[model samples]
Target: MSSDADRDGDARPGPGRAQRDHWERTYGAHPGMYGDEPSAPAVRAAEVFLALGARNVLELGAGHGRDALFFARSGLTVTAADFSPAGLDQLGARATADGLSDRVTTAVVDVRDPLPFADASVDAVFAHMLLCMALSTEEIHSLVAEVRRVLRPGGTFVYTVRHTGDAHYGAGTGHGDDIWEHGGFAVHFFSRALVDALVEGWTLDEVIAFEEGDLPRRLWRVTQTRR
Candidate 1:
């Protein structure tokens, strides 16, 4: 679920601006950069949701709605949320083309801002590789709390993050924390300790290691259920 990054020869800290702008420009510049197919982690998540009888899914950072459409087609109503307006538009276009507009909803939501979903409204929350994006440990924990708040009791929060075991983990510009920036993108690598700390108030179901892409982007697929 992790996105590609340049780790070989990246420079010092990128200048500060809205992270949303970076993502918007990234999507706008390269259409279908991540492609239309649902990621492997997403496919596994859909299976877990169906097993849990989750009828509605809230997907954070649902770029291009790939995973959202997969969930919707699997009979779960999906709300595909992302900060990039253009990304949402692409997702809407695809949903329309696939005649899934009825089952899928799109929203422009910045995860750094408060989530717009009502409390205890969704049966499941899924965010693939979104938790690793340029967020501090505090911010990541806060976001998880919000995810928990928006889930019904026993609803699952499924997410993935770049693992500290990744080959790219220590190669980029170091933040002296778990985070590192390369090619203007920041990724907060997750350790078992950090994940253990973040899963407070939820039951940790799994933390499986996996890889994606030719860079062999190593990741941890962590799952938690609201208590």
Candidate 2:
């Protein structure tokens, strides 16, 4: 989550339209609420992907497409996935207007479910603060497995998550050990132990403290690779 508020602009909408109907209404009401610039984590992660020679990137919870547009502008083809129809539509329109439509595709997805892409089809997976949503430990692990399955050998998965040390960690209603519900959204904070567990069966490249937004969301910028 981009500083517990946004990831690449803190996309607050989540899950599918069924149970989490709030997200649909939220996106519909506040279309393009986020700024145009991608988050700082996404900016840095794009450099890492390019260094790894990644060509195709699948971005989950793409929100308003700030990071997706940045990746496309940097010459990487991006599949921008989000659950909100309004968010996806805004992203599509922006991509077309920016002349990056050929380099970008938008999809509505429930991250808790199976990813729609074919196995070993992508060069990298970029999930900016998408992991901190209402996902449980098992579901988070499963999502990682899906990322691993969808990436070609040597592909990278670059993502960000709010760290437990942030001021907001214990402020919200407890959903789990490190999960909190506040402002009508649930966020799962991460510790190093959880990070290690999340990167199992993969090569952990780095985990750094990343601060963002005015409140300064303390977060972990995690980079891993499929063996």
Candidate 3:
């Protein structure tokens, strides 16, 4: 586990580093901020994984382990990675308390960095809202490439992203690259073209539209397969 100081982002570069610090502080202030219920995307991802006989799942940007815990309970070994140490701490504690620690591992990982896993080592990868963070289009592409590198052949990748149709899409302070900041959080709203570009090297399974939260965040729940 990284020390709380390491998560403070004093030495890291880019706006992403600042976002990391924001998440760290946010998690510190409100542990389990997203609550414990598994996201609908996560629930659906688990079914896909299990149907494929997937034994392990890698969850990127796994804030406080809501979905990680759910995956574990559903009998998949889970690696939950997030940039926020405070969030992972809560996740770890919850796993231990629920006796799910044996199936769950936590790591402090920034998506801007390369994933720590070896190539073709992960059975599946799931990210609920990670790709829509304060990341450049190039950075998002790079991260998806990393996801491809780590996932095995025939592995599934399920992710969700806020889209241009969202109510908040044009309401926030623009940061270029389709990214915007609102209420101290930055989001890169996805366009359909961006989504199509990302599936170039993979088998695009589905892009289902959905809505969530009080703001009724408009999102695309995308599923693809490693080819």
Candidate 4:
């Protein structure tokens, strides 16, 4: 098997075609790798979304449509987008199975480029474990800007990323706050200060840092209004 670092090194953009092809192959090989359920952080983020009374919700990298399904089940209009057609296929199947075909819409989108939505079209945007996949800080910032651009005035942007202070910073071992690059793919770490700087226009609502077992994690829940 190829190491994570090897995979990170091979993961790069190529006129959209290559990127889409790569993820398609990956998801095709492992149809439901991310499973049919949302992660713990996503569940936690949903609580905040519920409290905010958000109606039109966008999941930037909706891998398996897990969180998207959660929002749809709550009666929110959801647009679940991913870069991989294979992933979207699985998500669509899951949505149909959950009887959310009407409430959930699936799209193939790559966040590294301009988002496929009109400005201020979405009420809230949620991305779980999406930022770290970016190859560089510039890409990360661009993704954030895209999220900001699509969000309505006073919309909320909630996401969770690996904590920077973790012990295994960058080995693709899910440790520490280091940038792990392997097999054309990478995971970037972020500190609270870095996130604040990246999210320049957004208000810093809350930065929660905690350890899950041996790993340290950070949850950033920010609510920003359009300026």
Candidate 5:
């Protein structure tokens, strides 16, 4: 007998692709889920970019445009990208409402694929809690390479990731490669070594320890510059 799994074939997407559906539903269920305020990291990143005279930025995993809109308001041209179209729609609507449509643009991007921008194109990049998504180590490395490819020389890249010290690090269902799923959300907790490894060939600026949310998720905000 051909079971349901057999009939469906082996076309199932990996956890990373499945996350797109989860995020779509999440955004649909709760628009502006992360609130309208810019996160602490975004505010700090803006300071860094402005100090460096950065005029444009590419933001990955930009959900609902809270930080992207903030960057636009800070007088930087912004490109916001995420895998979920629903999230981008909300971001677009909010940008229009805030009269930031001209300053901000939205693109649906899966970081696993090559980035859409040209080489040495952007002045800065910011990703908050993005690298910690259900991506594997190899995918993370590839995405970082793409980030470097798109950023101009001396461009700044600021990103945050939930680290191994987080309360939920070993909790929930383990999906291998340090990925854990809880309440429909999957995360790849980062080790210190992994963080150091990602900075290869770049000038490592600083790694700050921080906490966020009710769970007080432990995270490291990493800043680096292209040599």
Candidate 6:
């Protein structure tokens, strides 16, 4: 939770211990996992920013920099941070291959702690498919607080998370969730009321809950501005 820990160049154990370990093992076992595309929610949220002429975006939990690459290519200064070193490595490689090495900067840091950037240094913070899987409500609040701390007044926080109404909430998808085991961790499902309370100080600009494809998925798309 310390600022030094967040900006630390060295890796250290943090609050997201189980979540980090789960992703490390998951991505390690299947290096090519998740392919090389940004999540649909990420793409949609980025488009909203583009239309609004927002730049200097930061992506928390940027798994493999898929969305980071897209933002960079769209002419936004992007800083993508992830807790997993392996994920950042893949992101760097992908950026290099896509000729986006100059546009994107990859950082291996935990967002549950203080972020590396200076206060109010970014125009927007994007967290796609992040923040919902924390084992505790405190962790989720901490993550949201960090986002608010780094954003300037009126700055936007755009993110998506698995909806509580989804059928996969209690079911194990072979990728954690279900029961909280050693390798497996807790996944918190959020409802609209929960999200509203989480962003109390912020002005809610938009909220969308929709199902994607054939998977009984529920995605909460929230766009909020700092108060």
**Model 1 lDDT, full chain set:** 0.84
lDDT of 4: 0.70
lDDT of each: 0.84, 0.83, 0.91, 0.70, 0.91, 0.74
Candidate 6, residue 218: CA error in Å? 1.4
- Measured over all alpha carbons after superposition, the RMSD of each candidate to the real structure, in angstroms, is 6.0, 6.1, 2.1, 6.1, 5.4, 4.2
Q: Tell me how far the alpha carbon of residue 224 in candidate 2 is from the true structure, in angstroms, after superposition.
A: 0.5
TM-score between model 1 and native:
0.90
lDDT digits (tens) for residues 1-227 of candidate 3:
32244443456544677788798899999988899899999999999999999999999999899999999999999999988878989999999999999999998887777887899999999999999998899989999999999999999999999999999898768888888889999999999999999986799999999999998899999999999
Reference-based TM-score of each model: 0.90, 0.89, 0.95, 0.80, 0.94, 0.84
Q: Write the per-residue lDDT of candidate 1 for residues 1-227, one digit (tens) a residue.
A: 12113223323243213455788899899776788789999999999999999999999999888899999889999999987778888899989999999999998776755687789999999999899987777778889999999999999989999988988788878775677877767788899899999888999999999999998999999999999
Which sections of candidate 2 miss by over 4 Å? 1-19
Off by over 4 Å in 4: 1-23, 172-178, 182-185, 211-227
lDDT by residue for model 4 over 72-130, one digit each (tens)?
88778899988776788888998888788998888777676677788999888888767
lDDT of 5 by residue, 13-80 (tens): 45876776789889999999999999999999999999999999999999998999999999999999
lDDT of 5 at 102: 96
The full ranking of all candidates by TM-score, starting with the best, is 3, 5, 1, 2, 6, 4
- Candidate 2 per-residue lDDT over residues 1-227, each given as its tens digit: 11112212434343322224566677788887778988888888899999989999999989889999999999999999887767888899999999999999988777777888889999999988889877777778899999999999899999999978988899867766577877777788887888899777789999988788878788889999999
Q: In candidate 3, which residue ranges exceed 4 Å CA deviation?
A: 1-14
Model 1 poorest 10 in a row by lDDT:
1-10
What 10-residue stretch in candidate 6 is worst by lDDT?
174-183
